[model samples]
Target: MKLQGKTAIITGAAKGIGAATARLFAFEGARLLLLDKDEANGAAVAASIAERGGKAVFRRCDVGCEADVRAALDTVVDVYGDLDIVVNNAGWQLNKSLLETTAEEFNAVLNTNLTSMFLFTKGAAELFIARKKGGAIVNVCSTFAVVGSPGYAAYHASKGGVASFTRAAAISLMPHNIRVNAVGPGTTDTPGLHDGARDTGDEDQGMKSFLALQPLGRFGKPEEIASVIAFLAGDEAGFVTGALWMADGGYTIV
Candidate 1:
């Protein structure tokens, strides 16, 4: 019960790492607000948690939109009475080279993958600072932030920006007892990865290549990444902040 009695908002909770985090947090006794653009999946995840005797509410939200971000935070306050943690797990990626990527595509990826962090932190902090309560923020980044990869120009830029933003936000919010950190995951077996594989025209080949890159000789599971997020959000991470944790199975080490 690491998060017992705490209220947490998990954006992108419809599936993948976000959904996994929601389940683990719920199991650890958190009151959850699951936010996602995928309304159906988000609701299903929340309902599944409820069916298991955990408390959760699903809200449809576009993390990149300022109004949506505000409304989601407002819902958290109105429904849960207080906010203890936020997992900014929403992200978008397009596997295209700079020459092939359109300006619109670049901006859209940046808005969803990077700017949403600014919005969530700013919006949620208003309530946290006002109520004089401390909180934790966990941003989902990617190993691409540190290691250069062919294609995905915008994705790389956005994730690199997230890592930098995490550090800056942590330093700025420290006085208020807000701990901001990031989790950089390697090639994980998420729906997004499958989608990326399809886009590249070979799911099996992509998986094999990805697995070969990992020192663990396998892909990461969503639950593995979520476990780290759970740890960072809990009381055990009280003394930790401004850190970028690699949950990538040593993918970056090689």
Candidate 2:
């Protein structure tokens, strides 16, 4: 019940880490707002939360769109009266070489993964400042932000941007008591990952490659990552800001 009575918004909440975070936040007593482009699954997650006795609502949003981000937060404040936490968890990945990545593809990936963070942060910070009540923003980053790989040029760039932007945003918003931080997760078992693998046309190989990178010899669970996010959002992390909390299972150590 660390987040009892708090209001939270989680983008890309239809499934995977976003879904797990929604469930966990609900259990902790936070009023939930789940956002995703997938209309069906997003609504389903909200319905599931209600069944579990948590207050939740779902909104279909393209996080990369400013209008959508604004509207989503507006709806949250309208329904819940205020906003306390926001988790920028929506993202897209591109497993392509730099030479093969088209300009449009790169732009789209950046818009989805990096620019979306900008939109959410700006939108939520405005509300937080106006309310005169500081809020928390937990960004979902990746170990790829720190590590280098052959393919996924755009994804690496976007994630790296997120890592740096999180710190800059944290410093800029400190005066308002609005905290910004990031969680860098290693490869996790999520629908998104599976989908990404399918997109690559080699699901098993993609998974094997990911597993090989983890010293733990296994993938991470959405619930495990969600726990970290919950801690950062709650009062326990009041003093922590501008930090990159890595939930990577020793992925960056080597």
Candidate 3:
């Protein structure tokens, strides 16, 4: 019950790590708003939470859209009177190298991975300040933010931006008692990972290639990453801010 009685907003919450985080937060006794472009699954996650006696409301939103983000913030306030934590977990990935990546594709990746995070962090800080209440913001970065690979140039850039931005935002919001932090998850066994494998032009082979590089000899779990996010968003991490907490199963160490 670390987050008991708190209200939260989790982006990209229709599936993968986002969906898992939402569920964990609910179990910790937090009311939340789940945002995702997938209307059906997003609503279903919320419904499932409700069935479990947890307060979760789903909103269909493109995190990259300013209007949609604004509407989402408004919806959270309307549905739950207060906002205590915000997890900017929405993201998209591209497997192309810099030479093969298109300008449009890069922009799209940044909009989803970096720009959306900026919006939610800014909006959430504003709400916290206006209410004179300090809050927590946990951003979802990636191990690729610190490491390099042959492909996924755009994704790497976006995640790197997320990490740096998290630090900069943390400093700016410190005086306001707002804590900003990020989680760098390793390769996880989520639909997104399989999609990335498909982008490699061979799903099975791509997965096998990925597994060959795992320091842990297996893929990470969405729920495991969600636990790291929950720690950052909870009061237990009060003294933590401006940090890139790694849950990468030793990915960066090697």
Give all TM-scores, in the order shown. 0.98, 0.98, 0.99
Top TM-score hit: 3
- lDDT scores of the candidates, listed in order: 0.93, 0.94, 0.95
What tens digits encode model 1's per-residue C-alpha lDDT throughout 58-88?
9999999999999998899899899999999
Candidate 3 runs further than 4 Å off: none
Please give the lDDT score for candidate 3.
0.95
> Could you tell which candidate, 1 or 3, scores higher by TM-score?
3
Q: Candidate 1: how large is its RMSD?
A: 0.8
Q: Which should have the higher TM-score, number 2 or number 3?
A: 3
Report the C-alpha lDDT of model 2 over 1-254, residue by residue, as the tens digit: 89997999999999999999999999999998999999999999999999989999999999999899889988998999989999999997888989999999999999999999999998899999999989999999999999998889999999999999999999999999999999999999999889777876899997887788789999999999999999999889999999999998998997
- Relative to the unseen true structure, what is the C-alpha lDDT of residue 236 in candidate 1, on a scale of 0 to 100? 98
* Reference-based lDDT, residue 242, model 2: 95
Instruction: Identify the candidate with maximal lDDT.
Output: 3
